[model samples]
Target: MYVAVKGGEQAIARSLELLAEARRGDVAVPALELAQIREQLRLGVARVMQEGSLYDEELAALAIRQAAGDMLEAIFLLRAYRTTLPRFGYSQPLDTTAMRVRRRVSGTFKDIPGGQVLGPTYDYTQRLLDFDARQPAQVACADAPLPANMPRVLDLLDAEALIEPIEPGNDPEPIDLTREPLTFPADRAARLQNLARGDEGFLLGMAYSTQRGYAESHPFAGEIRMGEVDVWVCPEELGFAIEIGSITLTECQMINQFQGGNGVPPQFTRGYGLAMGEGERKAMAMALVDRALRCDELAESNDAPAQNQEFVLSHSDSVEASGFVQHLKLPHYVDFQAELSLLRTLAARHHEDTDDTPLCKHGGARP
Candidate 1:
């Protein structure tokens, strides 16, 4: 193989230089600052952070800049960096009910306890390109401040026992997916963790499949909220939890109709999703796929690709998938040469066998 040749090292070094040159583009253009990416390309940073399984905005922005706007490469960079950091004590589970609401909406209800607060969304705007994006825009202010906390719509259903309750402590103690190997028949905690870090586009397609009858999970957006949620952690010596920090989060709670099965009465089930930053689409897609993966647990028929845990989880990470696919670009000289030799030998043997056979009319080989 060429790798065993003397010039292999020099070739790799030259390739690296070419890659660096290409990544920078024309030197006349100004380089993107980390803050610029963090502020302007926030949704891209959010996706990198979510898929990277890390929450640092600055690092995510840096990764994006380093990858030259390639999202999968940025995710790979961040994930590589994340593995080197030392492990710290885990933070306590977040309480979303206490989230300081910024954007809240419910597809299931037109008017709810908290009137729909549409904060900074593109849904109402025209899809036309803005030629004057660089110009400063006039802004409007609300007459009064929004309430600090709003009740979750799903809780209303839970009040009447119409929906299944999801109490935190009921599940098994969660393990860090990065530190341990994933085992089959994964619990909800592990599955949710996997989906939280899954590729958004992949989950989005899978979710869409469910709506198209691949896995019929008749779903309604019970609530979709985006805001800052306080993070708390407890030290062993303190014996009580204290506020560490707050992080922007988007949460989606999906209400799905479930008929009676496995000795359970007919009721509305739940599919939950949470993502870092304002990732409404990612969160919603995650919720749909999360519900689909729970077919076995919910005693529903597992007949769809989305419902298959092994297939989904194994290919969800963009970093892993990209590496497996992109590795094909690497040197495979030896392997290709062996295949070429085999094909030529087969061709030669076919010609030798047919040469001795008599050709009848119509140029056909006779037995």
Candidate 2:
């Protein structure tokens, strides 16, 4: 009645066939085109691009389709693909102040210069499902052309020295996390890069924990902006920087009031987060967590989960988390057998001790 399972090759082949069929749903219906997904499901594509660490909408859309709409899986696919590609060169530091603003808003102020433009957002829409999405509808385009460049609200504060000024200079370059192993006491750039590709849900949970008296950061979202910024890179031979390309980025600045300690005066501190694509939620969450992790630098009490940099950054990736968790399903008979033997020995010893008669009773019976 009991037979060892065989034909693993056949089983694997069948599973692949089934997966391909499922990914391609109905033969009669045309396949979900990559361009369609990129344009129509732009938000989903954006999420994939943000977490995937690759700013390619078309590839992100394809990964989404291949992964059957699982965002994390799509991210994994994109990351894997990105690893195979050769690195040409590094891009120049983006000028966010000159970003072609699509959507910009500031939570700290009532109104600021370069007035807030809430472009193409679902923020106001009620979360109701529309049953009449049979075909996409076209709306008439606006007659007026948008501005080419928009100044950041922070720059206004920077001019007055109301905000902490970040001096622009060539800081030490960061090590690539993909190529190099992560070490403790990481710099801000490296930490930010890790958090950008981090799992949104995990980071969000950790960020929420801080709000609930964990790290206890009184954070105000100073500003959150989404738009395209030109990436420029200066090759050693070029002698000057040139525009490489433009990338969509979401940047978040968090202001946390820290009564200064550690020989520093009280000042409004800053936490920053920037992502490669339109990822407002992730960027915002990352900013909060980033500030929390900098407790030591800010002289704030480091007593929360988010404040533990090693713990937070190390476990933020879903791909790593998922792989380690699911690896338990693989064969562990040897370890299981070892545990079983130990339990059996303990049980046998217990039984023998319970069954033993008193030595006095045995001597009396003999007498």
Candidate 3:
């Protein structure tokens, strides 16, 4: 086994130089500014912020630029930056009931308190390339006003006692996942936190598995809403909460059938998901995974991949996953050399065993 310690050092440095050159491309073209990424590629920035578990648009934009538009790397950069920040007092839980909703839809009901308002969604758009994006054009707005606050669809079911009622402060205090190591049989809060920061594609695949009969779940998008929700924080001296800021969020509430288990009457159960910014798909997938992981709570079978807490939470973080996968490209001379020597020893033993074995010279079958 050859170790290229000296040559590898020079090669890595040169590779970095080439990467910088490739990232910038020609000198004539203007470099992409942070503002451009923040405004033009706003969705990417939002996803980076959500997955990174940080809410700073400026920092997310800067990370996107620095990562050369690689989303996982941008998320990694944002997470790294967030770890260095001071830990201020924790904010009070956000009130989504008071959200200034921009889009609200319900698959379960056609007519709710607020009519279905499909605002800023690509659900019905034709999958065609826009040739006009090459040239700037003035976009016109149509005036169709919706109410500021729309009632949650699930609330309607709760009124009739058709769904479970979650009293405020009934559950245990949530564990701060970042500060503590994840253990088996995690609580709902820990699982949701991990899923919020989970890779979108991985969750999507896991969620899809349930639909394909990997697990038993029949879900309806009871309600999906996107809006700006106020964040509040209370200082010890103040003794009351004050609005700190407002951030865009997407909330998905999934309704699933609970077939009379755990000494509970047959009724509808809820799986909830909420994500920073307008990430409806991520929220939906998260809701499905959340429901799947709640087998024990529901007294259902936990014989599925999505139901396994260790399997899902352990591999959720994009930052950790990206680091581990990308680290393979780096030097592994010592590790490979050890494996090579082991393989040679095994081969020599196999050859000696073959030489020791007795062989019949006759081609015919033994009597």
Candidate 4:
């Protein structure tokens, strides 16, 4: 049996009107331009693209504007738009090692090939409010031209047989998570893909948990690189791969100590993360969660929340989480009425049964 609620249309219309008014409050102030958001709030755009699994900056910016500055809503809009596009072809696996080195840093090495090129970072910026009406723009020029190519820090450790080796040729064909439903015991590629789009705050908290003795992890930022990487696609007619422009990316390689088990010698283990645009925090947090999720493969204890893939991946999406949590505000009168009726029936039955019974010493009624 179903009974539809009434008067929701007027409420929804009024709510939408209120939202529009709120979104463009006070016509005196200039409306936010899409280009402004694209240029100034690039990090926010990058986050939307990464989570939405779409790389179009312009569309992301538009989505951001339409979402009224709500990042999660922007991500949802982008993701919904992504579903309408037809699949052309899958791009080749990106080679982050060949990134046109920009901001490269390593915590384990004091001096590496790139010499800790902190190209653009807020590490040294003082958290102070600016009082000046007009702020001066920074003028930066590279000092002692950076090396065109820098060796990955983990590769250096691999050369000396200090870290567990990743056989380049033996990787399994990655499952297309976008097409297939994600299941338990996911492969490394699937896990990486899932984490790549996982909610930033959620993954950040999970990563922080690992650092706080949740998973017994002692991880180091072996390398955190931000640069441009070329995208390639192979066409059936061409029989060869062609470059499809390049996009900026941030890659994080976390190195964690691993005690040998499962017939493998003790060595440093690796966790990889790659994100669209300059998303170092996302990359780093993904790396940490990646390492934590590999507890079983690395022969470590799986007693932490990060290690639970079902729990982590299920709640990782902003769109799904927001829908579920926000849906609580919707009308539930019918369901509530059903529960109320059941409670009344139970009370009546209980009263009938106890009507002829005497009061117990401990209480007024029993059963």
Model 2, position 303, has a per-residue lDDT of 79
Q: Per-residue lDDT for 63 in model 2?
A: 95
Q: What is the per-residue lDDT of model 3 for residues 338-363, given as tens digits with 9 covering 90 to 100?
A: 99999999988997987645446775
Put the candidates in lDDT order, highest first: 1, 4, 3, 2
Off by over 4 Å in 3: 1-7, 142-144, 356-367
Q: List where candidate 4 sits over 4 angstroms from the true fold.
A: 1-6, 133-136, 348-367
Candidate 2 local lDDT, 155-196, one digit each (tens): 766677555667777578889888898899988888888998
Whose lDDT is greatest here?
Answer: 1
Collision pairs in model 4: none
Worst 10 residues of 4 by lDDT: 1-10
Error of 1 at 118 (Å): 1.1
Two-way TM-score contest, 1 vs 4, winner: 1
Model 2 stretches astray by more than 4 angstroms: 1-6, 140-146, 159-162, 354-367
Candidate 1: stretches off by over 4 Å: 1-6, 351-367
Task: Write down the lDDT of every candidate, Cα atoms only.
Answer: 0.92, 0.83, 0.88, 0.89
Residue 192, model 3, lDDT:
95
Candidate 4, residues 215-267, lDDT tens digits: the string is 96899999999998999999999999999899999999999998887789889
Q: What TM-score goes with each of the models?
A: 0.93, 0.89, 0.93, 0.92
Measured over all alpha carbons after superposition, the RMSD of each candidate to the real structure, in angstroms, is: 2.8, 4.3, 3.7, 3.5
